[model samples]
Target: MSDGERVEATPIDPPQPLGATGEWLASCREEVARVAAGFQAFEISDEAGYRDAKRQRAALRAEVASIEERRKSMTRAIELAVREFKDGAAEAVAPLSGLDAEYKERIDEWDEACRARRRDELEAAYAEMAPQLVTLVPFERLAGRYADAGKWFLRSTTGPKAMASLEEAVSDVARNERQIGMYGLAPEEAEAMRAEYFSTLDLQAAARHAMELREQRERVRALDAERAEAAGAPPAEESRAVASARRAAEAFIERDAQAPALEERQRYVFEFELSADELMSLMRFVRANGIHGRRRRAA
Candidate 1:
């Protein structure tokens, strides 16, 4: 029989209530059971019986092919119907979904703008917190110094507490700056002090380090002067005792040079009362020769 006739002979209608679909499927199973029983009972003892069984097997295969074709056609119809329903539902809600997405985009942009504004305000506030004399230190430097504290940033920081912390930092920088100037340090020593202050945030330590550096440099200069004087002095230009004292001082400085850096040095304090001209001359000599001197108020 033709494929169409085979399908028409066993029409598989759309599913409905259990009554019609289940009965149709039951009838198909009954037909298969009858065929199976007939094949099992009919023994192929003769050549004629074998030929009959082979013919029946071909018919069974054809029936299975027809059922498979019908099943494919029904499933294709169901899939098309499902796709159409989904497209219709999505069309109904398209405008609302678009509106939701647009609103979210606007909110995100506004939130980012607020965050940018807050960042700018934080930088300005940090800059205002620095001392006016702290010209060398920028806001970036200050922010980096306190960044790990987490309170210096925009979200967690408060006005009064931030001001207090910044005030402490400003005080430190100001004190360090004053000490740097007060010591009348050489240009190299002043730079070293500034470096130490920024690294350790300690004023006394920076000052003490600069003073030690100054002392080392002064000792070298004093040794060089002694050598130059000894080598270049004219005959009888200095007394023997004075020359011997100069050599002894140079040797003492060299011997203690190998000592530990933290060791205390011998300090000699001299009080001078001089006329203005003499004082000016002395000050000029001290500065010109890189002498380490500190003024003391008389009691």
Candidate 2:
């Protein structure tokens, strides 16, 4: 019969193509992620449930990471296909010509001010520690009595006694220096040593003072280099390390030329100049021989 028959149909969406820019693709991904997260087992109150949740979460995380990598690869072609544009480029460049050097100068001044403040704090702490410094009687003596003792040696039996006192003073000085070196090491006698008057107020204070002193030493190292140059001494030899770092940077820039859109975190990708296998072989080489500027410490 020509009578109308009941019919039902659900509409199916046509396959949509992604745009040339990654921005909209990113938005679409966020919505999909929101929907997926609604079913996640993110909470657990018992040990068994907690263990199960951990494994589930881990699997989900792995999937998420895989998706992120694929997404980057998919959008990379669009990023590469686009040409560079210079909208208002001259306007931006004209106002920023001299700012870099000016900012560097300002930063150096600020750093020096901070260093000066730290030095003052350390100096004040040292001043308090000076009064309680541990030492033998002769080592701490400001009078000329110890000096006279040396000359008085040939006068009588006091010669032997004077020699003994001098030896004692030398031993005391060595012991004090050794103890001072251990100030931050938390030796059993660290507190007891601090009581002697030569140490910083506490272990934490001692460590901070040591770090500041190290930084101060580095500042002097540059001056040392300048002075060495002035004196006509041979410049220090360049270490393999410095060369390695330079090479690493050059390698990165060279790779960037091939894939300017390559994210720093996504260094291993097929979109680069090399095939995945070739890239992986290069990676293995870098891992063993070291990258231009980076080296892993020997195990």
Candidate 3:
């Protein structure tokens, strides 16, 4: 009687929380309302407003599509730019001559400038289209916290412990963004940070280079195998000598072609003034030891 009476005296409220899809739908509805309001507010007599409304409607329709063609195009452009810069760097400094030095500097400067400019342009473009993009989805379903009050209530009811950590992570991102904006970093700095971030995500030029190198290595292995099959056995001394000479000639040609670009790249790396030699040495060590492939056994 005591427990039943106490429970009856204190009525429990039913839990109400918005799920991910619910949040998205809410956001989508909010976006549609906002856009509708904005369109309504436009002066009917003004030709500019009429044009703007038409353009915005078209953009909103595009946003309704699951795939964003414009964003995909921009991302592809950035990827291409990165690839071009990398290839240019690779081609600039093989022989390590003074001419190569100048070329290296020019290439590096141009590449860095291009990256900064491109990133800024992309950011601006995104900002202009953001409103339309928002309208494409319901707000509640955007896949982040703070979309609706129901999410908070749900978290509080179901997983109270995780609420603090989630809030902290969101706070951390906000703090970082605030710091970045406050610092007013140079375009070059911003671009560098962007590149670093993408690199961490395995989306950078170096990652592409690594893949290309692996493909080249595979081709070389295939050629070696084909040669072995055709030859059937070890060649006589004279033939072996001829094959050695041929290999040496090919190596010399390859080195000659690669030298200028490598030297230029080295100079650019050195310009950073951050122990470029040591870094290159480490890179070579990693390649020679196959560190990327497997862990080495202790000698």
Candidate 4:
């Protein structure tokens, strides 16, 4: 956690300046030039250059160190600016996300309305057929009647009669089709009523299916909401604040981008001079603004 701790070794590169423009790179030009000049002064290329560099490697190292230090400052400053900008951007987009979610919920309600209406229409159609259905016997009832007849026909014979009753079996089944209706239904009407009964059953099934679908959708939405809350737990007001910060930063950044190079440098200096309160505001602004375009564009 120590700020001044040496953590890792890395290759040194020319440092760039931190700003909306390339001025940050320019600021560290002196450090880069000194390193380059040392390499050149020692003629560090072939046998002679290698020998000279090795002999004066200590001096070369000092120059390299200076360049590295300047590079780190530039990198650190730019990172801070970028971090701030993105935080602001995240805040700005949050409100828009909420609006988007509201619109989505409305769409879901509309879809459920359509499904509910369709389900009602099916049930209504089914209800209209109920009167006719009650008049006719169901297929199951007809089967049960046949089953009862079988019990009688398959009865164990008494002492005087030990044979199967063929007459009973044929008679029971002969009237099977006609017996499907409570009233004496003609073949065609009986078939039609049978179909209508099935249609009623189908409607009942469809209504149940629709209800299940609606319930499933509700469950999914609840799960999604829970996950979203757990991820950030951001309240409505907090989200709006982030959104507001993002927009402000974006607007400020746009204006700042148009300023002259000197004015841009002044803004960078202002970053250092920021108070704690101002720094937070700046972080939100810069984060929202999407600074550096390198680390934040993808985000």
Candidate 5:
């Protein structure tokens, strides 16, 4: 075909009749059949033919959609009738909602009473297990710690099973607390272990951590002592003081030796106060250098 010429489309048959809107549907189908029979098929020799084919296809689709909308409109009376029936049924049952809630509340009240009885029984059993543990930590405090751990007071849990679970928890805590106390740690160290136990709930791990810290401190001190001994001196700070004192004494002696034969060794006295550390350093230097010095206590 030429660019301006259109080809004829082969017509497709309409769908079969269905539902209560059959006659109306048949009429709609006949309209679709008539439109389909007249549809011109266009070869895309140019943009104009493509545009005409697109517009015609869209118009066919819109006709079918209008038919569907009318079919839906035919069902609106039936839909409204069903909705009104449901609303009447709902109105008839509306007053029963409060009665239903009341029945549920009554059942819940009985359940709660049963639960309260179970809770009392559990607490009594706990009281019996608590006395031995009370010396280490208060029973109330221990109870509070494990309060949220289990649903022991529920009707589903048997009395003996709940008792056993609670007893185990209480016993474990008491045992850990006693073990920590028996370690005989310093007050601050004990406090740290308690904090660790509270945070992690693992007594053995906390004890191990404390021991590791102690070992590290001991190793550091031992290394420092060995280093000081190898140098034939006190600790680092005291050794520095001793070296300073020795240097000052040597400088004085050298200055005295160069003092032009100082009138047949005349006596010179120097007086000054020294801190405990400085005094000890001065005495150590004097002894090591074998310098004779007189000791006098101030009256």
Candidate 6:
């Protein structure tokens, strides 16, 4: 056809199918239903039962703390025993010190590993809980919308009435959007959902969240290792040993003092007097770090 006589080309068919809007809305509704189901399973409520669950969680945390404290005490005791054995003047203490040294080393190693594992477990739990929390409000709203829709559908009859009901359904859809908007869903989630409503079924955002959680878990694990090593070390008593050594050295200059030289007195201070304090400090440090002091062997 001549350019001037050419008919204007018909507009290319739209990329999406006819009725795509309705299909998208339907998919959104299904997602809303899925989320609602999950929330229902979660059994979340601001009721007395939820309060009781919180109390139970608190109690469990307290018990975990107690167990951790006991472990620290045990570690400290072992460290003290070792220090005393090493510095005690008597030959009888040497064997006991050796045993304590071995025990302390083993326990510290195990504690480090356990601390890492605990951190990982807690990280995973926190990550899982985060997404669920985000979904809660949206799901609740969706559940309410579905209920209203079901009620409206049952009593409606005429075309005008059905159109009114459809408008209500549109409002319900808008409400869902508003509810989810508060979560600040990752841009990717919004983009994917916008591109294809069916993409909501994919949990890529949740997986990304899980990966971030794992990174945090590893960071915590490394920190725990450093703290555990520091706690396991002999306390300030090492400095006290040197001070005692110096004092004993000066004693030789004063005839009336009659104290032995640094070498001889150093053993007495480190082994007999400071061991208990060193052990106590170590125990307190470990407990503060939330490391379980007790060795739990694999069954």
Per residue, candidate 3 scores C-alpha lDDT tens digits across 1-299 of 46456433456332222123355556667766775665443555788878887898777676555334544654566566667766765676445567778989999888677645543443344335444433332222322333243233232333333344334434443354344444344565545443442333222343345446555665665456445535653432333434444445456556656766553322111111112222233334334443343322123
Each model's Cα RMSD: 19.6, 38.6, 35.8, 41.9, 19.3, 42.9
Clashing pairs in 5: none
Give candidate 4 misplaced runs (Cα > 4 Å). 1-21, 41-52, 116-299
TM-score of each: 0.35, 0.20, 0.15, 0.29, 0.46, 0.18
Best by TM-score: 5
State the TM-score for model 4: 0.29
Off by over 4 Å in 5: 1-41, 46-55, 68-90, 132-150, 179-185, 195-299
Would you list the rank order by lDDT, best first? 5, 1, 4, 2, 6, 3
Sort by TM-score, top down from the best: 5, 1, 4, 2, 6, 3
Best by lDDT: 5
Worst 10 residues of 4 by lDDT: 157-166
Q: Give the per-residue lDDT digits (tens) of candidate 2, residues 67-168.
A: 778678766754543322233444556656568778889998886776455434433433344433323222224113233544322334353454455554
- C-alpha RMSD between model 5 and the true structure: 19.3
TM-score of 5: 0.46
Q: How close is candidate 2 to the true structure, as a TM-score?
A: 0.20
**Candidate 1 at residue 181, lDDT?**
76
Which of candidates 1 and 6 reaches a greater TM-score? 1
Deviation in angstroms for 49 in model 1?
A: 76
